[model samples]
Target: MRSPTARTAPPTRTPLATGWGTRVLVVLAAGGVAVLVLPLVALLAATPWRDLPALVADPAVLQALRLSLLTAGSATLVALVLGVPLAWLLARDDLRGAWLLRALVTVPLVLPPVVGGVALLLLLGRRGLLGSSLDAWFGLTVPFTSVAVVLAQVFVALPFLVLSVEGALRGADRRRALVAQTLGASPAYVLRRVTLPAVAPGVAAGAALCFTRALGEFGATVTFAGSFPGTTRTMPLAVYLAMDSAPEQAVAMSVLLLGLSVAVLVVMRGRWVGGLPGARPPRSGQDAR
Candidate 1:
């Protein structure tokens, strides 16, 4: 054929470097996932399946479990009632020393739970400053009571709810809420109708976290609540008690607590992971781009 047709060059790849980079990232991610997953797997594998029913049915275990749920639930409710308003104030108000107040609010987060318990005892114990007045006037004692258990858990967990809700409130568009208010909606109406919907996921996440933290509250409960069975004792208390005479029992209780913790985390992940699509990710790397 007369004139040779021009030869076409093969399409070139984007680059081998890009492919290698992706491979390295995937491998690193896989390793990180493995590191986190293996411990949970080991705990499940080591669980005493045969003894689970017996351990669960044990009266002491049952009592502790019941108390744990009751106190943790109560604490979460308390946090919701008090912490939500506090979060609103932190986010929306222009109060003086607001930053200082926020720092104070999170003090419990850094303070040791045992230290928190001791502080509570100092402020609310039988011989405590207010405790003395409470005893003299009302003949009331908080230490070693079921109420004390709830109080301890709330003290340690309230900050989690407050901080979560406050962050959510801050991130949400205030303009939308203001628009609702300008459209003849009352402040309360705008908050209930416009603001709360935007922050529901954060509230859910905070509650889940508070519940989990309260469930595992051992140091404070032991120090202030005294681990009284059917009264102040909770799942963590049961585990500690079982550690001495029945090591198997201790391990069994540990497995139970572990399971409960994992369940809470799973529920939190499912409920809050992608619930607020408009909300920003906690870290820059989490951004989808």
Candidate 2:
């Protein structure tokens, strides 16, 4: 009898779709990233390094920075107050015309900033519809004022916050909220304790984005608020003005703004990666005891 030898099966090789199309996609993606990076590289290379300190410390830059911070902060606060509830309603409630409502609220995101400024002007200018009444009743002028900057920022930034919060609400576990409700927790209490905590990460991310957008607001703020130094001129408006007379200073301003934008992204990266507050880790059966 011939000795039987065990025959081993050869390992099966899986074929991957690494074709020409894939190569083309990879090349295109790299090219696209390079295009985006080149501008910043050029900007940094051309920046006035020696005069940066004096340029940034100039009164104009300081004023613009102060105004930008004030307006952006105010806008963020306004967005939180109005947007959080709106987002909650949009995400959880079965309201009629919700889609239409969302579309209307988000119109500013797509609309040109200049157009939005004009729209705000028509709605709140001295002789505007409600504006005329306000002036008549209380002499409260809105446009061409500091308040106008905040309003413009809020108009442009609200959608970012609302969308963020709504996404968080949608992704949250509603079972805990329901359980709270069943345990006789008031709606308000549950919202304050359970709902807000669950969506806190989105809220934080949204606030940062909103503040960033408000800080960079240019067109609407210029149109509706008018760029008056120490009154309504923001950092971006300062940049525009400085570009004509002080190109180097403008570059400095740009660098600061760029740094701020980068910082916001760096800070919010963790939230985007799902490291949310109040989110509990899964427990093993033995650990649960």
Candidate 3:
């Protein structure tokens, strides 16, 4: 020991761990969190606890709740069916005009909900564009109907699914898929057996996000579908309508929506960041060990 001793390197400090950096970062982060959380806190404080049960039990509330669940579920289903393939295509680096396509897919994320509704209406309304032909030939009128609610939800929620899946596909390891292809396996077989399993977590996360987004859809649904109870009145629309007449009911419905959203986020924690505990994909060189 006296003859030879190895020297060890000192630990390095992260940028935010030095001097006043940590304190400043903490203060700013706290402010941002407070901005986001205080409204929910106030909502809880203003909720009429005693009347909550009665408010939720109202027929109109029940109808809106049921319709919201149905349309959101349907929209999620549609997104899974349509968005997944688009995501797969988008993930390919070789695809032409991918940037343009991705921008179009994400347009709804930034576009005003009411504007999206107007666009949908122009395309599907009884007298506009293809709507004229649809109505004249098939006797179908889409606007101000429950079908319109589902369509509106789909327009907004589909992007979430597509983006989530595309990210997952891009990050997934492709060696296994390539190896399968080299082993006389068909591309379809490799995709079904090797590719999809690696990205299942992404697909599930996308579906959950899609469902939640659809559940909260409001402006587009209201503008294009019109809020008719038991037909197109989703929970958000119900809350808006109740605000003018019965604020207590509106608060109660809001609390319910808040609870559902929180539950979904809790269940999906760590998924969007990486993967669930037992579901995380192996890191590079991990398989060799």
Candidate 4:
């Protein structure tokens, strides 16, 4: 008889209940969701739905809404203009002190908005470090103006754009860009035709995030720009003012903001912000080889 064939036992999977690490992860995840979701639920439940339309229709609210959108849009555009190049440098270049540059770029993310506003005021106030010179030379004033609102929003929103675009650049396969350059494409042409397309998803996500952040900015705008109707008083500042004098209007505005956030997330889902990656084509049943 032939030698008996050797046999091996199949591998076994540990059940979830048997894994303390998995149990801890599940608990943590549950807690995180609860902490985030509960507040939103409470806010929605307390919303004054019956009078929302009228509240939002107030002239004061409308003025704030227009100013907010305008400033946020301007800020987002500025972020894109500056952040894309910075992102490319961060991802692809080997400049000296790159780490320091990145740290500086990201500082606003962790810095308190009020602190950032203070710093801006020191830099741009009429009698401030740069502002004094500007005032003396150009007769320009930045602080407590509409321009100040845009500046504050740009300061806070720029990091989001740079980080997102840099990550996308790092993740993208560089072979295509290299090949384009080798094929005599100019650097600008290559960036526009090859690099940007590869990272469009990240760019879109970054822009959305940047715009939303600018829209919601309060502390920096309040401090640096001041709440002047038809000038620097954006929606957040309006909401703050309303909360003190017109709680119902404040609730309505808050509800509107919540709705906008939800809508953005919903519309932006898939490839850009998140959801799922594209699926590969199904394999053929048979291979000739």
Candidate 5:
């Protein structure tokens, strides 16, 4: 037994690289996160807690909150209905101009919200080319209305939804989808029963992002919708209106916005991790769907 043990080789240990580059990257990442967190910390520290309750309870504040929730929710719904299909197409189809289409979709993300509002006005205002006929035939004026707010929010929010869903669809195993089809599932059935379930987490994350974007939308909402109290005014508009009259109220609203943003980030982070890169495949032979 001693001879056999002596003849056996020793166990090997793996070495990890701990170079200066790695240290620099780690320090930079930590600094980046700290920079992002400092502003929220300051906002909370500066908040006048004694007046926050009354400030938030103001009728105007309530109206803005309600309108913000309504319009943001509606815009998210619109994004979901339209974006899912667009995402699916971009992910699965072999269209010739797919790259160009994707680029166009993200244009609103880079364009200033105010510019988006002006573009909306030029296309949909009462005197606009289409708007003239729309007003003449149906007496519909989209601008300066709650509808305008929803449109502007939708325009800005749709890209987030599409990109998220498209990413999910692309990461999915299409070969598994083909196997499902060979097992007698129609394309629609496969999509509804297979693909949808696999990518649902991404969809949820996307909807959360769209809602957050819509909730914070300001320039387009103000420029196109005109910030009428109890109608077009949302939280951002309320904050702006409060800036001149009640700085404390504005700060409170900003804090609330910040809180909502944090909540969305938390929820989305959980869903995104559980869904995509960190997600494990189904343990059994059955597919994820």
Candidate 6:
């Protein structure tokens, strides 16, 4: 008779032992990848490579590039300053109405960019409600300025940072923070020294996402900030205008933006994989042993 161990042993399986279900999933995944990748491939194929240098060197292109970089960077900084605390609050289990607050925070992600622009205009236009107060009290106007560009960017990009950092906060182990607090460390000290470091990767990934999203923002910026060259027109707006007047330049700008976005993704690949939710960090060799 076979021993108990042999009887209990399960059959071995090969990697190629996938059934019809797995084949169907693989085919579907390939189709999805093609859908995502073909447009990018077409864009690259259509680029006028020889003229790219001169197209990028156009004064209008340079101006829009400068404005895009400036506003995106400013928006990222503003998001970090404001979103971190908001993310911390949202991550707290004891916080009331957290689901509602999170929903509100993420609404912009799904909201139409033009609608966001309209909302911003209604709130900050020269004759708007709070805007009227600012105009009366301070002689300040907001819409159609470079400042408006930054505000539009912040409105859309803030959610990315908040959600990323909040996910990190939820996934991180809090034992060190708790121990520090129990050892009489100030709340601020524990937060600054312990909590932030643990979540630094998430913060970095979120900032990258915010910068990329801000760089590509168009409808909101055009609606609220206007496409004023050297003042408010960003690269996306330039690309849009170029499509009508200079298709080659539009292609070049599109390629440039695509390159920048790819660079961000390459730089943050490791952080995104390790820091984001539902992904386990790779183990060390010793751990594997």
What C-alpha lDDT do the candidate models reach, one value each?
0.85, 0.88, 0.88, 0.86, 0.87, 0.91
Task: Give the Å shift of residue 237 in candidate 4.
Answer: 0.9
lDDT of model 6 at position 214: 96
Model 5 ranges off by over 4 Å: 1-19, 275-289
Over the full model, what C-alpha lDDT does candidate 4 score relative to the true structure? 0.86
Taking all chains together, each candidate's TM-score versus the true structure is 0.82, 0.88, 0.89, 0.87, 0.86, 0.92
Cα deviation of 261, candidate 6, in Å: 1.1
Candidate number achieving the greatest lDDT relative to the actual structure? 6
Residue 75, candidate 2: alpha-carbon lDDT = 98
Model 6 TM-score on a 0 to 1 scale: 0.92
Which candidate should be chosen as best, given TM-score against the real structure? 6
Candidate 2 deviates by what RMSD?
7.5
* Pick by TM-score: 3 or 5, better one: 3
lDDT of 1: 0.85
Query: Tens digits of per-residue lDDT for model 6 on 166-261?
Result: 989999999999999999999899889999999998888788899999999998898899998899989999999899989999999999999998
For model 4, residues 1-289, the per-residue Cα lDDT tens digits are 6557964444445665748888899999999999999998988888888888998999988999989889999999999999989988988666888899999999999999999999999999988999999999999999999999999999999998888888888777799999999999999999999998988877877888888899999999999999999999999998999888998899889888777766775687554553112322223433211
Runs of candidate 2 exceeding 4 Å displacement: 1-17, 273-289
Query: Candidate 2 — what's its lDDT?
Result: 0.88
The lowest-lDDT stretch of 10 consecutive residues in candidate 1 is: 280-289
Residue-wise lDDT of candidate 2 within 1-289, one digit each (tens)? 5457965454455675698998999899999999999999988987999989998999879999998999999999999999999988888677888899889988999999999999999999889988999999999999989999999999999998898888888889899999999999999999999999987878987898899999999999999999998999999999999889989998999999999988987988767434233344334444333
**Clashes in each model (backbone N, CA, C under 3 Å)?**
0, 0, 0, 0, 0, 0
The alpha-carbon lDDT assigned to residue 208 of candidate 3 equals 85
| Lowest lDDT block of 10, candidate 5 | 280-289
